[model samples]
Target chain A: MQLLRSYQLLVTWQALRKKAYLPLMMAVQTLFSLGIVLGYPLLFPTLDRTTIYLIATGAPAISMITVGLVALPQTVGEQKTEGSLAYMRSLPVPRLSYLVADLTVWLGIVIPGVVLGVLVGAWRFGLDLQVSPLVVPAMLMVALTATCVGYALASTLPYMLTVIITQAIVVFVFMFSPLTFLPSKLPAWLETIHSILPIQAMGEVTRGTIAPNEFGLPPGAFLVLAVWCVLGFGVTYAAMTRRG
Target chain B: MLLQIEELTKVYRTGTRANDRISLAVGEGEVFGLLGHNGAGKTTLVNQVVGLLRPTSGTIRIDGRDMIADPGLARRLCSFQAQAQVPIDGLTPRQAIDLLGQLRGSSKLEVRRRRERLVDALDLGEWLDIDAARLSGGVKRLVAFAMAAVSPGRVVMLDEPTNDVDPVRRRLLWRQVRTLADHGAAVLLVTHNVIEAERSVDRLAILDQGRVIAEGTSAELKGRLGAALRLELVLSSDSADAPISPFPGSSVSVGNRLMVGIPMDGAGQAVTWAESLQRAGAIEEFTLGPATLEDVYVALVGGVETGPAELEEARSATAA
Candidate 1:
């Protein structure tokens, strides 16, 4: 526990000390999220209940996705290339504890943007947000799962390959995945996969919290996110602890 | 013993043996140097000992704990400075050192004390507040060393710690290395700087092709060359010779430099012969000294210090 605390302090200080990169990355995340919220409204000018729910909930989910799929992996890959990863590995700190610390910093950076997105969507589109009690917990789950998956990819793959994979994920998440749209719009095959994938589940959980009953929030969505969380953490831990 | 490696062997997936049946032990307060040329398996051996690489066959014990079975103990007991300059990103030297110390389980006060000492010792006062990335390579190397020394564990492994350092800072670095050993830490220094090794190492092992060719104190190893000395004579020209084997041994010519190996008994004859050559304008400048770690390394590793031609000349001289 002490080691974890030290890692938390170390990671926080490390991120805070990066005078330029931290703020730049955070700005990109916030603006990207705001862009999604504002741009989607333009596409659906005729206000409807479904569009409003999608904009508010989907905006937050997009922030999580951007952080998880882009910013986190890039930072990790840069560290790996620069030998900081080896420095971290040489320390006596627990491997999982380092991951927890890293997740905390990243989640801290992205959560503000998530809250802002929710607020902007509610204010701009007049979303009658029910704001379920589970919103914070659901948001935490989304952030954790996304960060873990990114960490797993960053730690396990070569830097160049990780970059390529991250780019691919960005394209898939924004253009193909049904995170912001109805599942009926996706082809049967892709929707079948998204049913089990965490992206759509993240949107469903977030949407269910704010617009409960209007959009189906199957208990199974929470189950899917939980399973993904377990899988991500499991793979990341195994990768970090694996012997030569 | 603070650290021990028994019959350690590492065979990569490509079937290249990096360390072959290597065995050694370092006691507390001992600074053991590992000397080798590039691809001599020095780094491989250190990596295995630090738990960064898994040996195919061997047992590594750190503070008497099995490293492979208990890597956590190894991590806690070893502080390593890798060959590459530590990438500090944007953290100042002070922050980096403190963070590493705390991560290594040092107390706040202890970390602060050590950080101050290191910063002072390494002359980091000017660069202490500057970000590591903006610092010069030599400064970065010093900061990395400081990070390693902040809270040294029972075993400290430093790989090429003085690579980019200046001569003045290099001296200070050597003192810090000795200080670590004096504090009862087992220091493993892997470097190609045999000259520095003579001053800093209590004992050393010279590795070649994944095997230890020689291991002993500086005196003991040089003793193997027994009254044998190295003569580095820069010839005025590579022309007419004046009894090339002046002292009854081979004298090989490497470019304009002719290196001759001589025994104590043959010193007079060799000096006389070189003087005659000098008079004849065949020799320009010359130096004679006791055999160095470089000489022993060249003799054992073969052609490491000198080129292929020099090795051939030395081989024929010995044979003759």
Candidate 2:
């Protein structure tokens, strides 16, 4: 594990050496999150308290989801196409260290977006009155789960196909998913579908912190999210450990 | 033996037998060359030795440790310089060397010492700080070579190490390889460059289509031609149709040139025959020299005159 952490630190340093890209990406994430949370309220000024509360908390969840489902997969796929993945495989380090280090760097990049989105939402909407202790842990789980799923997708598919699939996923999450809006707004049958998807469960947990009384998630939400986390990590591990 | 491989075979799922039953051994402080044309299974054999691919059969023992049972031992014992350069996009040459060395379990002090030595030897001082992506292909290959050599290992496998290197730098690279061997590391050099193999390898194996055709020291392989000397000639346009043999052995055509082996007894007649052909305007150019490693390679892998019956018939006809 010490060797794993050392390798993680080394990889992180090499990856983040160009400081220009990190801040630029952070700015994009912050603005994109702000756009969904603060922009939606401007378009629907007459929305009631619960709908506004859902958007405020769901905005951060969206930021995490986008990073995981789109950015992570795209970056991983690029590494594969560039032969960096093969180079890493040639190293003498432990096989599991690659995953642990890669996830660490990406998670580091993603978790801040969740924080910025949550803080920006609270500042933009003056409605947050209480904060739960579960917010940090919940957000971390969501980001990790999403990133793992993206990594699995990147490994399972070729680069071009991964790119197209990740793009479709980003578009669906941004436009069609009930992440930033109430599930009641969707048709009755569609609501049944989101109940099982990890995205809705993620949003509920994220929202629970901002509006504990009104939008708090039940224990079943965490359980469903945990199941997704286990499945996602299992796939990513299998992909990393696969030998040619 | 520093590295011993026995009956290694790799049968791909597509039914392509990349590496047939092959065996080889390399001792400490020896530079062993694997010579072959493309798709001759040199890389496949190297990959299995390095633990990148599992052998369908046989055993690879490095320093008396079985690599199959403990793949990590292969990593610990051998460092490989692959044919394709490792992608070093964002990192500089120095960082790449340092990172790989450290990842290979070199301490920081050891890494720094090796890095300084390798950078100096490879003449990469100017480009060490530049982004590797911006460097030339040859420079990247040199950096990759440095990365492979920086760590401590008993065996070093260099696959086509001189592909993109300039002549001067290539000489320097061979010097480093020799120095590494002098320091008691067993080096496996996989290349198709016959000239480099002749110059650098202490002993070598010529692989053709996943099988070893010949294995010996350069002098020994060259000596396979016995007392025969090669007499090469470029025939004039008018004389091209007529066979030009100073002393009849089988002549092999390479482009418009005809190369024939002369018995040591017939070698004295070569200069007289060349003079006669020159005066008659039948020959444009000619040279007579002892058979070289290339000659042996041509005879073996090129399949021009490898048969015992053809050799005996050619000798008897020449004697007649």
Candidate 3:
């Protein structure tokens, strides 16, 4: 009963706290997603059907991933620097309730962007999307893993370092990861690194679900994402629950 | 005692001792003040009580339950206003207060009533709907106080509650603090403001260098200065550096101001000496009043260096 009440309170508290900037945040996310979908094609004179499918499906994945990895961390870092995080910790609410509430809010913020990205991608490319039944669960798992990791980073590191690390992550995700492209195009060493990291798994699961006919589902991707999701929650829980 | 602390000690990993073997208790209907200068361990002690920080070695009891063993219970029993103002950039005073009250498990109607009372009491009506980011620091502080006081538990711990507040609102805030205690809550107030604490707290402990140097009712502490009167002189520019201890008392000098302790029997002589100094253009003005808790504080905090020999010499000189 206490857990349920705390969860309800935290959701309302977090939603109100974000009410002012949520619209602006969503607009930015939409723009970023639209930019990838609309602008990336301008870089190429002619795109093949396979290329179109990859870019169209990859836009939504990037949008969801960015919300969790980039936007969530920045917000948490600001809260940490402002001492609001410590203030919240001092409350009598259950720690897990706070974490779940935060994840729920960030998920809400990203959903519109993810949907818009997928819609705009299909319309722009005039491509066929074989959306699988697993799409919703796959998107949720990717977002949960990324956001929990971001939360853990912000909770454990100093604010300035978290900011810097998040920025570095943005560059790595956009430039190095195979989210928007084929893994075979990258060097073997880079692919090997991506195999161990969660970013590739996030993109692979997302791509498999959104374009199942074009890409096969890899059993290892789900296992990798689940491992990261649990690890992130564990680290974040430890950080929040530790005394002094 | 509603809130009891025994030998509470907190030492940071950096090896700095923030609190040292401090022990104190507050009864259910008491407004107890923890008075000290900056870095004197007052806020540190409050943080431990509220479970934001852990004490290295100590026992905290709220209503006979060991709080250190169960910090969740500590948090449930103690509602705290942190030293830093809560970040509510996008929130209004009303929303912030109401949300916190609900978060603390108050009913919606109860939250509304408490919010209205706090807004009226703090004179926050004009700024109730304004964005807190646009409000002044004092208003934000008032909002933070309201948030904590809205659904106060068995104990309410406030740290530097009056720091940036205006004089009028400070009095109102004090009234609310007392009201909290009157409703059967133990109030633990931490601050560096001596005069306000003396006026507001039923009992207080003065901390220095992480240790409690003195503790008692305001009158009891002031009585330590035993019939000593405080003679304050506004020295003229020309006499700013003059060593003007014509009477028997310990004196502390700060730029253009001098405070001297005089025996009550020497009140007339002290006044006459002040008049003489004024006539000679050594001082611009002077006032003589009974020593206050501030005097006892300064003496004990080593501001006047009241050593045994100096105290004996002052006594003999006053007698002669």
Write the residue-wise lDDT of candidate 1 on A117-187 in tens digits.
78777777766677878888988988888888888788777777888889998888887877678888999
Flag regions of model 2 displaced more than 4 Å. A1-9, A12-24, A27-31, A34-59, A119-131, A184-193, A210-214, B225-290, B303-320
Angstrom error at residue B155, model 2? 1.9
What's model 1's TM-score?
0.88
Q: How should the candidates be ordered by DockQ, best one leading? A: 3, 1, 2
For residues A69-146, could you state the per-residue lDDT of candidate 2 as single tens digits? 898888778766655565565566665676777777778888888878878877877765587878778788888889
Candidate 1 segments exceeding 4 Å error: A16-19, A38-49, A119-130, A210-214, B235-258, B273-284, B302-320
Q: Can you give the TM-score per candidate against the true fold?
A: 0.88, 0.84, 0.93
Compose the digit string of candidate 3's lDDT tens values, residues A149-171: 98888877777778888899988
lDDT per model vs. reference: 0.79, 0.78, 0.84
In order, how many clashes per candidate?
0, 0, 0
Which of the two, 1 or 2, has more lDDT?
A: 1
* Candidate 3 CAPRI-style tier: acceptable
TM-score of 3: 0.93
